[model samples]
Target chain A: MSAQGETPVSRRLSKIKHIVIICSGKGGVGKSSVSVQVALSLYASSPNARVGILDVDLTGPSIPRMLGLDGHPVHQSTDGWVPVYADGGEARLACMSVAFLLKRKDDSVIWRGPKKNAMIRQFLSDVRWGELDYLIIDTPPGTSDEHISLIEHLSPVHSRLSGIVVTTPQAVALLDAMKCVSFTRTVSLPLLGVIENMSGYACPCCGEISNVFSTGGGESMAKRGSIPFLGTLPIDTELVTLLDAAAETEQEDDKPIEDVEHEGFRLLRRYKATSSAKLFGPIVENILSRLSGFTAQ
Target chain B: MIAIQQPLDVPANAPDHCPGTESDLAGKVDACEGCPNQDTCASGQAKSAAQDPTMIPMINERLAGVKRKILVLSGKGGVGKSTFTSQLGWALAADEDVQTGIMDIDICGPSIPTILGISNESIHSSSSGWSPIYVQPNLSAISIGFLLPSQASAVIWRGPKKNGIISQFLRDVDWGDLDWMLVDTPPGTSDEHLSVVRYLKDTVGVDGAVLITTPQEVALQDVRKEIDFCRKVGIPILGLVENMSGFVCPGCKTESQIFKPSTGGAKRLAEEVGIELLGTVPLDPRIGKSADYGVSFLDEYPDSPASQAYLDIIDRLRGILGDK
Candidate 1:
């Protein structure tokens, strides 16, 4: 299979230890945000683990902006094009997205099937991701061309390729998310678990938790389907604001801060600490444990 | 190649066991090797074997009757593209003389059929093409949802297949002389968007697009890209509709910001993009209930704020299309 026409991509991905794909059947379910947070959490938890995030949501590339690496371009090297690197606390995280190649941030990519397929192929094969512990891919919604292409491209190269289905706590979303679960099963991709995003909203002023769309749908869906339930992420307005601000900040030289005296940054820092401690922390731990179990096997 | 010892004059409607069957000439056409028209006959047979030779022309002829095409698009998913489309169809069909048709191009998660309460009916095909399921006398609809075997079945297809089916929906569906054709596309500026715009614009010029978004930065952020898509493709922007702007409690009737905007909401985004803000729809619980039960909220709760907003939006849209 490596000697086939897909040799370049399969050979390129052969170096990665694990490739985890985050997907959902429905759009606007915070799938991209979950992918970003999961990658960040993985980097924060592992001391020496090398992580890379590949935003394959070509038409709606959000990872570049979400992680403050929007305008960064891909640099060419002898091996291939090197991915852009951003400091993730103690570890360095590599990122790649088609957004960086666009002339404008608002430029829409109106591409057809063959062109998109070629682009995804180039993204997989041309990006020189040097020995990494994890390569997390963020795909657009639905179990269509992009999802099938990614699974087929990565499964032959990496044995540890798995999928994490993201969903909101609504029956409509769950109904579609179930198709994502079935998609993974049909493709024979390993199921890491399911993460229910925007499960509940915690009031920023009074700290009262409200079920924005009803909370237990995701957990029940996971249980009914016999898949592992990762955890639920509360709808944090402060986190949304912080991420938006981070994307807008133009300073490329800005380093990760331990503690800031500025009021807004301080609040952002506090929110990150609390939210990760409460939500993303456990989710990342469960994912890492699953990967470790797979490695052991 | 197999040698053909049989005659070339085979009857078109001959029985299976007839002397010179059609199947016998399939590969045994080597006998016509010296004939001048052999190339033409072989090529014609190949074309016919593939599929109908007039698929594109058939689609063009079918859509030639549609006066205006308005695509309902959004960059972000789950922003109620289908629900809004269903409501807009109902609203437009309220006029006794107006004729409206909806083409659900969201092949993967086709919710239009279910939302419009026509999911149980299967599409019927004629010599012309597949006939659209009529939700009302004046309002007809078509969706991939109606073609599925069951509600649990999923359409796991690639780009080319989806494109082909979407083209068929436009060309093959029998939508005759529609005053307005609302095309509901999947989220993002990808395959479905490109296909719908190409087919509709090439057949009959598209009127424009109606963008939908929520009053949240997360949704508005992606909708900005959608607006960019419309501009790049040369599709005029009719306006933007902000759905679920605020949630109205049924008990207290007080509007509260459920998904508050971190980035100044849709109105600010519209201002930044230089487009008109058509209307804002409050998050009414009744809308969801009606949508789930496959009924029209405007007809059930005409006095509700959300329904009223839809009416206002419909009026503005009619003004733009000059349908009034």
Candidate 2:
């Protein structure tokens, strides 16, 4: 590998190609879930591509719980703060958050802006993150200090960092997302697109899709602002169940959640596959290409 | 020489100069309780007392230098809050009659310096205060963008903290007497907008605020919400400007509304909110192109339809402010 600490554009910069921040303008849009899926999507396309997910939300860090990574202590060694590997033997995929280092996972991090920026900077510089194809930063709701600091600090290095803003199809969410788009554009960052999460919900008994957050808010906002519109995600209770079950399963067990033997796990995979193929695949490819400074055909 | 020799015997006895204790110093400070500079000295000492305690007085002192606070908000974002702010600032500066500055509170997505054609190297600070780069001869501007590391970084802020940051921007910046201060707020009636309005209402009164919107149903709906917010806060509505209302075809000079033409977005909303219609910006390619190229359309194409429309808006705003 090229010696570490090279400039972001240098050929020796390694596996890390771009940093994509997955955020929401308002809360309860499944921002973390979308972030996880985006990280996994990048990995699925290029399995060996190094990837890191930094949960800067501070308040609602769902990576540990969602990935079924629980009770894993973050390893601190001479190489810097090392993210706990889920599979242990397999290559590490993402970084563990400061949330995991706390005695209690649910405690609030009441840090001021400068210190928050300092912590986020530590997450970037102190972490022994190797060259990776992508670093996904999942941020909480609203435009405020932490988000500004993350974007400001990272922008100088990652010139091509694109944003995947998630919003529900509601007036409030769209309004906030619209501000988000303007905010992103103001700084001259390429708006990758808007993702409409919880676009619809399907009742298993009725076998019919129902508008959950009122569909088309994202598309309308995108159309109005002229931003690229990413595909929508339906609310699936089974996916939630599978995620919960995955967290409970032992990492090394033969019946691990990824094994697909679990019915809920199988259902989750099928849903992800269908959604990834139908909606997220193209969006991911487009963003990755854009950040890599390549035009899509 | 003879006069100096007379005091030599007493010169050997030096005055006692023992360092005072903390309590003794506190007593001395208490003794100056009613003095005008007492608070300044006390707070200055307190700031150095801790590794990084809240330096309340220093921060308050920084706030005293601000002048001419303006709030640039829209019922919606795509309607051109950022665009209007940049253009209005440019227009003010273009005219030798006024000096202008802008503070972008759109923390989620700051674009002030960018629209003003400023770069990372352009944003600088000095002993005087954080210096805003002059976009026009008399216009200086700052945004959360200037403080950012890059456009791609995520701005993840919450409500209360967002308020604190806005306050800091207002009170901390060394904005010397400005003819006008334009604040570009994030869309919606959220904490960002509320923070700016509240700060102006509670601490400093705003002269007036302009609302930007397009002729569209979705934008109109949010406009009503924003209007209600302003009313609740008692912030005076300066006027409403319709942006991107009708697109004029470059080939034929034929105007067409891309989202169905209706006066409802700005005009009707202005009437409903009991405010005057400032003006309408035609759907001009030059505006978009100028924003893309980081130059105000007025500067690039002085006679363009968009530029003319912006000039008209400025005229109306001047009338409202009695800038005869």
Candidate 3:
């Protein structure tokens, strides 16, 4: 209660608006990409807004890569955390992860729970996140130490959290998403909505929409739970390509050559221009409708 | 010396003030003595009493009213420890003779308050100390999760903090005497586990540690390490639960191992470690579904196979403890 370990630093950093967390039951559910798109959408919609993303997936942090922010140096200031700029200072976003701490890029995070919790608290306290529109968090799949600690650290402000449960269309994915959703309720956190990613796959050659993982599960879950159903996303090869290219071009101005296979570059460019309308419009609308008076953008 | 225990309701104005820093409150007992309610508020007295080593008056005063202290532990994560703990706690609480209290030492993964459907309970600290939220009529529970502000809030504490919390949970929460106190520890043999073992070893001997593991080779491999840790620490290994041993198809009632159905892991390890194999929990999707809704399968589907497994485990545990 004295906030001994938390210190005055965490006190200063606690003031922020709408901390939205992106979660998945299992890996490969595009949890990171969905988090990136949501943050980007929030950022683009409000130029004055400050949006930061914390990658809690120590071993597999993909936010920097998907946001095209790989290999960018993040330096700390006395006031708060300052994310190294990407695209030649075009965007200033605060990003921190165990991935950022490793001496080399490929080194694994071989830490236990207490150590993991310390780093998470450090990220919350030390980082000068500044007042922001949304602090998008990317959690590791399944309920692990990092995920549990993230919730514990944020519990004092559970009312402010809008948890977004992400999952693929598969039954196993839904099962995991339900566990994540239950975890939210267990911790007494508010249920924002559920996003079913990879709902359907559109084959590039055939231009047909096929239910690869079994569509409509996430929406049904949302309906059953009486929470908002934040629309579903189809499997687009172009989107995957856009993400890959974005990862490569995020930190630097590395332009992809025409001859090279970089679908991420082309798709993400188009995706960006109409992101508000295409990627996040329905989801945002659903969230706003459920929340009533609370609208981010 | 078995005595019937009555439920003690927490007073409306029982000490609602959160204990300040441990150092600040260390010598402030005389200041709190002026309050009308000193019995519960005087945990500082209980802490001093605990230092007596042989004076189990602290344990007797605290747990004399509580029936069983069922400690649930896991060798590692993803072994269905929380799920099993939730189910077992509900089953015991459902019995009239058995009042239940779950102390989740999985400070990092305190999922019980949500799993048992009490995540919204406001944890108020009274002049008496911290008040635990009641999940059932005779069942009360407490965890850092319940103490947290949100499900996403992380408890970042070191050794001293962890030790203080374990002691606070044991002494502060008003777990009125009656039935059982199920403790869900974080997976692995680490600081939290050591803290619990050390506390119980010094005070009341840990009744027993329920070791849960999945049938997977990876999970079983971790179980061996846990067994060795228990031996090193002199903590009693009660029994083994093979969770997700096989998934029972809801449609046909046919059981199959979704993650490798073989019981080689539990059987071989239990034999090697010389612990009883309690039972195998089927890979029932309903258990996972119930867990997601914060409902235990035992509460939702008492007649289900998963529920039965939990009941059998509890019965076996009762036999072990009662015999001793």
Q: Which candidate gets the maximum lDDT versus the true structure?
A: 1
Q: Report the Cα lDDT for residue B231, model 1.
A: 86
TM-score, each model?
0.84, 0.49, 0.51
Clash total of candidate 2? 18
Which of candidates 2 and 3 is the stronger one according to DockQ? 2
Scanning candidate 3 chain A in windows of ten residues, the lowest lDDT window is A259-268
Provide fnat values for all models in the order shown: 0.39, 0.10, 0.00
Better of 1 and 2 by TM-score: 1
The residue ranges of model 1 lying beyond 4 angstroms of the native Cα positions read: A2-6, A88-91, A202-211, A248-271, A274-277, B1-57, B248-260
The lDDT ranking, best first, is 1, 3, 2
The best candidate by TM-score is: 1
Error of 1 at A102 (Å): 1.1
lDDT of 1 by residue, A41-77 (tens): 7765645667899988878787876676767877788
TM-score of 3: 0.51
lDDT of 2 by residue, A1-297 (tens): 122335333332235567788866654466767777777667666646667888776543556656667556777778677876543344446666766776754233444456667777777666766666778888766666556666655644545467888887755356557666655655556677888876765545544555534677788888887887877777655454444344544443556545543333332344365433356687777767666663231
Instruction: Report lDDT (Cα) of residue A71, candidate 1.
Output: 70
Worst 10-residue lDDT window, candidate 1 chain A: A259-268
Comparison by lDDT, 2 against 3, better one: 3
